[model samples]
Target: MTTTPDAGLRQDRHLATEIPGPLSQALMARKDTAVARGVGTTMPVFAARAAGGVVEDVDGNVLIDLGSGIAVTTVGASAPRVVEAVEQQVREFTHTCFMVTPYEGYVAVAEQLNRLTPGTHEKRSVLFNSGAEAVENAVKIARAATGRSAVVAFDHAYHGRTNLTMALTAKAKPYKHGFGPFAPEVYRAPLSYPFRDGPDVDGGAAARRAIEVIEKQVGPENLAALVIEPIQGEGGFIVPAAGFLPALQEWCRDNGVVFIADEVQTGFARTGAMFASEHEGLVPDLLVSAKGIADGLPLAAVTGRAEIMDAAHAGGLGGTYGGNPLACAAALATIETITADGMIERAREIEALALARLERLRDADPRIGDVRGRGAMLAVELVDPATGAPDAELARSVAAAAHAQGVIVLVCGTYGNVLRFLPPLAISDAQLEDAFDVLAATFTELS
Candidate 1:
């Protein structure tokens, strides 16, 4: 069941010092020396503890958590059931490596994923350690099943950082720059980006456009999979136009191309449904999931038609640490909590609250070009009022100002001009409104 935040944890923001504070500053100095330059941090403060909707820094400062660690802690960071399950699993055993000895937890998690992922046809699931790994495995399974090479991705897509996924990803900076020599046979197509693509271009037209590009560029017969985020995450939480996903799925079905839904960030009730594909009544040939699967533990899965999933040879699809027992245990409990604790309804409540607050902010502020997303995952794109050009600098400034005031915020998008909000579903309404108060003030001051 869902438990309240720790008694000692206050559901309010408390600034003991400017953002990083003294302890966090000292820790930053040590981090600078010890951590790699490639690693990045959004909030400078080091978190000592986090519960419900608040994160406590080492300096005794309390900050409202709006980012949810990039949408990982949906059930909340210290979910009681998840913690208890992890502790019990640790006491029993940490790892037997599912590939080595196999375990019930692994099978149980696979069973849960199979039942939860979209589609009622005979299904199968394989667990991995991260979103990227699950995505890579999906691609592998598609290619194996279809005996095709080329894969099609879309614009404004952020799959992951691994080489194969990097090639599949569209952005060039940070995620792809200097990481060339990427995997081959990965092709790109246009997405139904409504804000920029204009309102006249409906989902059907957009799907035709994308399909035409794929046909002209990469023949459908040559394609093994067409992977996409149902509601693009990291790519600024861009929700595709209505009918767009359904049309694409239809095309994939006719063309014999495996349609893969990369629900890594949009799955597990984050989008007010078990999976975002359900929003369009679309059932993908393969669905990759992670992030909120195990609350905070590392676990991911690729669930799809049994025949397709079994395409890979007996030993072709597993890592040494894939589906570790602890992660599996945590995932089972996380799923149970989401089902029993009414987290899905909670997500819808969060969406209503966030959208109402954000709409009011957008109505008053000309810089907010658009406000779009589903359920708990939402974002506002910043743009110049007069020229309609992206205002990434203003976005950064607003995020920094919010950080100073003890509200954790995140910035994303291809142009780095989108401010995304992903509060935990377990966070109280009071805590959510308090965070927006800071956000509204930040926008007022910065704009």
Candidate 2:
């Protein structure tokens, strides 16, 4: 319940002018010239400072932050503990390269990953700079251990944007449109999207169908890994049906394929659980983590069974800035805050508030085809009411409308019809209510 000092500004939404007011519009011009065209932004307003649940823009507009920078700032951007840790670490030696000289902070983070990641088995961890790197390393470990080449990913899965990860990812438009030729040997299986798959196709049936596809398309013996997000992230916050994860884990166990849980988005209590796998009692052989790991700093990890992680020969894994001292320090403080500051319980509370509000919204709107996901990682899928077709335009309109009113929202899904809500765990209930009010108003205005 600790709040960061607001520096004489209140922690409530306050719009001094229209969003992206004069100053922000000027910055946007500069960004257009300096930044890459491929890079996209959700809000045009450049953030000057952020604390708790609000981000103050360059134009002095206080906007309610619902996206959390794509769920990276779970502890809130500029969290006191994380900032303090980073400052202290920077004063100390910043980097000696963990692979070359080594440091305690790196080992400490690896130890934390080993302990925090699911499974009581002997675990080892390797640090990476991003979720994509962690996923690629997980695949490497699986292949090295099993000596198999083919990897199985789900239909709506989003692993990362790296060459191998892009191959594992399902969406092709933005993530993989012109980025080919992608890496080979990655296969996609049917995911249990209950909303789209009809009522009869439950978790067990979905698992069977996916397994059948794997058997036919990529032989079980040839598969090195079965990578999945226990609660899917960018491919819309699609939470697979119950028993789907457990069944997949069992299949991976029965076959030689390693079960890798890509908890990049769902990790660190974003999904109302310590890890999304715990919801179904799944024990993935490899667990990938990032995003909320370091409270916005670049840090990712692959924690898995010791034997599998050690399958690679000496010096086979690692990067120059894999576990930078500052990032490690930030991660340690972030984890401590999550555990000691009751953020996990806060996540469950957030889930309750968000679902209650969103379910009400869905009840009133026919265009809302589905309201799904868990904890703070909730999303609403927009669809044409009459024909039941995905309505990407409606989704975009609602998000843009919300953004214009000083509430930052983000859109996702393969069809671009999902409006994801990833409020920070540290966000107050009042802030949440205010954001949802804006959301409701947007829907009312558009519908």
Candidate 3:
């Protein structure tokens, strides 16, 4: 049921009301009363409908989308292929509980994931409902395989909110703050942040330092796995140097620990390659995939060396909705579109346009600290003019100003000063130019 990418979507804007309007305000008041207090807000812009690269808010404001719902909807929002696949799958059945009633869709998806992810060795895959679940299950597989309890993660890493992953995550504020009794035996080390950690220090040196830390702190032999994102997502799209991933993977082989690539945000052609890990040609022992897997359906996966994957008890990895038929069917369509519809090439084109705009900003302004990323997964770090401190406020202001001008942008970083662009690969050239122009205007306004 999966169709090809079609821009048959037309943008329509009707604003008889404020940005939030009256109805949305009422809904917000009720939402504030009922929704969890600690929830994070993204522009407070309530969406009524979205298709392609434009999202229509409840207030009828049509805004150009640059976030792609946190890098999930890569092919595009309400992509015909995705919608049709979901619709047809839902009509047939929503949930069969893959474990309870095995289906071909789930197996087909698993087969695709194993084949598509990095490496040519014999591989196996398990499906889950979220990136966090996939990550946790990968760790479970590593522990079961090695009979070791220690796990090592990098600083500035953003794994997930689960108790164990939270412990693995490096950021302290929202994700890990006050949420401890964090899982034990989790160790953190400094990762290569070339922009800030120092210019001379590249990936190889950082990898050595990280390995030393593990051997000294956790003892390499006792460690079960070293989980890292090929391109750190929430911690800023910090693309590690060319040699970093290969070095780390080598170390894992020398030592007896599994190498897990948490590609939840970097998978499905987000980084020009099929998987970000493939950018460096390093095959991780286990890879976690989700977000863009099902084109917005809740789905995730863990694919790895078959021996490591099969180490656990037969029923060790699964969830009730882990491989829902609806999600699985959608995954099939989404993967097919990404691989066959030339979305990966489009992702590179997006990078070319975004890099050009960001480079201009960098050349024109010192406040723009750095512009770094591959493919559509790009971000610009902001810094104070004189002191060179992270200009977090300016980043936030730019995002707000862009939103006011009918463009939605997302900002994130360990220092809270980077504006990341993760637009859908199916986004058009004109839309990309329009988005760049809006960002340029905002930069001038802010200056």
Candidate 4:
């Protein structure tokens, strides 16, 4: 398929050699010494160039990308608009530091965020370097606005790797293992895990259960905010029951607690809706966004009601490089791409294509205990057929097989049994079908 010259890589998947051929292996050896041990890669193949739906590795293998750099590159690895914008911005100026000199790109980005984020109410935005930073700032604004200390995150939540966000996150091994004494005043509540929690509890019931926990453990009067992902990301592509988010939001409003929607992974048309929060009309008090916002640039933002966002003092809210001009230009262009390119509908089309395949697999294979998610962001939970217990080994085997066959997939969950698929909206129907063919074969082989 033809693509822009800037996005020079092809859209097709072609394995020129073994998965991680000698060149990649040599690079891996170098990376072992040069990079920190804490950083880990899902696929061993080193990328030489990437564009559209495929990533070309150092060994010349063009592998179909299903993970999309952990839901970052929604438009494509090298989308034309994003590339053009960044190229133009770099030629003009890379960074003057918005805090010191100020610029149009940063203000334009903030304006876009305020306008595009859910809710028609007057909103304000602040930029940051990462999702964790956006979330930290959101919490700060919440506390400043409400004069409260405690914030509640849900079970199976994956916030970020920072000190405060580590306390906010639910998983402990990799993200929070040795990082204690974590930031204080952070609490965890239960999430509406439909597959595991069983059939009896619907969204409302699950919300009440969580509310009860919040009320008992950390009272409403003491709470600053209740942060959540409408569709949980690293906690598995967990889509909570229909009314759960609204229920929690209403409670937050009544209790004078800020409702923060951490849309780091679910925003910017990743789900069928522009924001996953829109699925149920969840107009959060504050929305922390990153990942897909800048088409792979290091950018994040917290958009919220004007009053709450303005609570923080002028000197209290910014960093030297929070809103780099290049990143802002990328964000503006990415937003334009999403709107002009009909990416929201593309995400729905992907949902229709992938969900049907996954549902059929679930129906045929007992090991596929659950297949759930929204739009391009989808996942399947692997479980033991006999006992219905989580089969993390099976998940790993399936992922490894997919990787060996030149398809990129990622495994995540509290139990580590969920295989999440987040293909770029730019992915072709043929490439997606081919990836699924490989996945089907891998599952059958493992079975």
Candidate 5:
């Protein structure tokens, strides 16, 4: 998790043994034997301490982080404002259960979300504990408001792991493997993946395919809502074709469907905008916000048109720690920090810098098939040039080399061939340059 750059990143290595040395292996052995490893893992390194964009492992290797704690730490690690806010709130109270004893901190954060989420119309918001909860609530609001059932989610979409959201999600491996008998009335359709799109893959065509599926499977008259991520997150950072979102939105409005924008991974100024949906100027009936909402505290929200949000009965949308005081405090401070510090502009600047270096890397490495993404959220897809086939092994090698050299990275995509970078916006230009050099060296070494 991250807050703000409390101190310039310091790497104090006192390695007494190999990386993830003896002590860590013992911990892992215990963990595997006793704990369920059901969650998908990205890195094997265990954190001793972390701040800014650097993570100190138990072996004492200080690896420069590129994942940003899965996009939760936007301000930085150990940010003064976030720490101060959280500390003060903790001293006052941690949780009184917003449902039992309502507090103003929760109401204040809801007010902020109501004002910030797109649209000038009167809006309302409700808080939850996770992105999945917010997404689930969005569907509930739509279903309650529209009085219908079916949901339309796109291919490669990653909503959540909950049963209902598992139905909302498209991938079947870890999400839907044993979790059979998912919530019904959920249907999947092809997404507008520009990188994979060809002469036949226009927005109209993609929309037509989805529409046709909905028509044949679940009639539009029965479809209550269509949820989408303007920029797909776990599904390979696929930015939809220019006209795709607008086209789908028009279709939804025409069919009396509640349009839900799942901005769990894209919101809070991560994609060089307040929300990726703003990239196309499309407003949805409900907007889900989380991940970076509380600067790493477990806070999430559903902000949208008041009429649709109000359809749920009084007791329908309450949770134990739904709007925990400490989380609300962190959200207020995080929102203030992002806007007050001009973090969105900083986000765009970061995207430009990363895109340039990633493009250079792509140009030099034939194995690098494509470099694409928006803002600090960017990725490089690896492939075997001989047949234009996915090269997941090459990606693994590159990431391993980078990790060995004290720089961290992540890989995504259905075939696990895309390396995505999501460093904090507060990362220094020098850090970015060093990360690029580390990547370049990793490539050269792997070659």
Candidate 6:
């Protein structure tokens, strides 16, 4: 018989059995029968409960979570403050459909986003249920404000799965494959991928190339918004070169094109800063946020300049469950937890610890082509040492090995050769060290 753990999940790694133990295997079998094949799971192990840095699966295996549910639980899965706020709010009311009966929680979250996001200028926010929704709304606002139809996205970018966002995204295999007849007027541009482009193509040069392409093909007059991820999420944790973002932002400013920073994965202190845009002092016309916004709640927002946001007509941007009361409450509590509990400092600490270990690994292992990312968001691109080619097989093997050993890591990138790490700030240094040790051993064993 299966048994649940204590109220507080133990913050330790304990593999009771193989990765997918009997209980999890049984559950997976059930899921395979009941669930749709399109919906995928990274790990077959089913989670019973999670807290701090560990997730206890149905088989009683307490695995160290480095992925953080795709960087959703920055404050941990069950942050006390968030739990308390959600509990209280759920008791008070679950949903009243903000568009129908406005609530204070929704307005409060909007206010917090406006005050916390980069610029000090007068701004407004519109809440949504997911990152794709936020992105779609941002595009709507940009088009409405500029009266233009064309939008531009960067290479290796992952906007979302919705029709418009799918058109905006650059990848083809999983996200856009089979789904045909995408939304129109979406264009793709090259990104400043330092690892691939080499050091000679500096940020400014990359920006100039992209700007030239935009000018020649898309044109400033037709482009409504130039949407990009400050640090691309699904397309690998690709961080643009130093001056790349600033130059592009300047270009957008001169051309009157709305610049949208999709901080869905990089925002909320995931990059050691409250927002990744802060690293380059970027004040985008629109900023999209989600994932860590409400500490695991399904909430997202598009915060932007008042003039641009006001362009959207009344009732034009909203949904039935846009800003659920419980989600809003959780967001407020999460913001407090991040600020009051020094989550930003914690993220920096994670970065220091992770980078040091990853750099050491790279120094010894030729398979590791590059070690990059900031704060808790880090990754290593695995390649064939002999030919310097992406080794997707090696990436899959490493991730499988890590899962077998009770350390949860994720693989991503356009080439599927990147092993990304996104541990929660709540994870302790000792836990991170242990996870790294496991990764090192796994690499050694594979080598």
lDDT of 5 by residue, 1-447 (tens): 444454544733233455656666776777788878784456666778777667777776677778888888877766668889999999998889988888999999989988888889999999999999889999999999999989999888999989999999887876789988999989887888877776678877877777788778888889999999998888888888778888889988898999999999899889899888898898888999998888788999999999999999999997887988998999999898898888899889999888989889888988888887787788888888888788989988988777767777887787778898888777777778888888998888888
Tell me which of candidates 2 and 6 scores higher on lDDT.
6
Error of 6 at 282 (Å): 0.3
* TM-score of each candidate structure, all chains considered together: 0.99, 0.98, 0.97, 0.98, 0.95, 0.98
Best candidate (score: TM-score)? 1
Report the lDDT tens digits of candidate 3 across residue range 109-226.
9899888988889999999989988899999999999999999999889999999989989989888888888999999977888888776788899888888888899998799999
By lDDT, who's the top model here? 6
Candidate 1 stretches with Cα past 4 Å from truth are: none
lDDT of 5 at 79: 62
Q: How many clashes (backbone atoms < 3 Å, residues ≥3 apart in a chain or on different chains) does model 1 have? A: 0
Stretches > 4 Å off in candidate 4: 1-8
Deviation of model 5 at 256, angstroms: 0.8
**Candidate 6 TM-score versus the reference:** 0.98
Kindly report which residue stretches of model 5 are placed more than 4 angstroms away from their true locations once superposed.
1-4, 8-18
Separate clash counts for every candidate = 0, 0, 0, 0, 2, 0
Error of model 5, residue 61, in angstroms: 1.8
What lDDT score goes with residue 138 in model 3?
96
Residue 129 of model 4 has an lDDT of: 96
lDDT of 1 by residue, 183-260 (tens): 999999999999988899999999999999999999998999999999988888899899899999999999899999
C-alpha lDDT of candidate 2 relative to the true structure: 0.92
Q: Model 4 compared with the native: what TM-score?
A: 0.98
lDDT of each: 0.92, 0.92, 0.87, 0.93, 0.84, 0.94
Cα displacement (angstroms), candidate 2, residue 337, comes to 0.2
**Cα-based lDDT at residue 357, candidate 5:** 90
Quote the lDDT for 165 in model 4: 94
Model 3 misplacement above 4 A: 1-9, 12-18
The TM-score, computed over Cα atoms with residue i paired to residue i, of candidate 5 is 0.95
Q: Quote model 3's TM-score.
A: 0.97
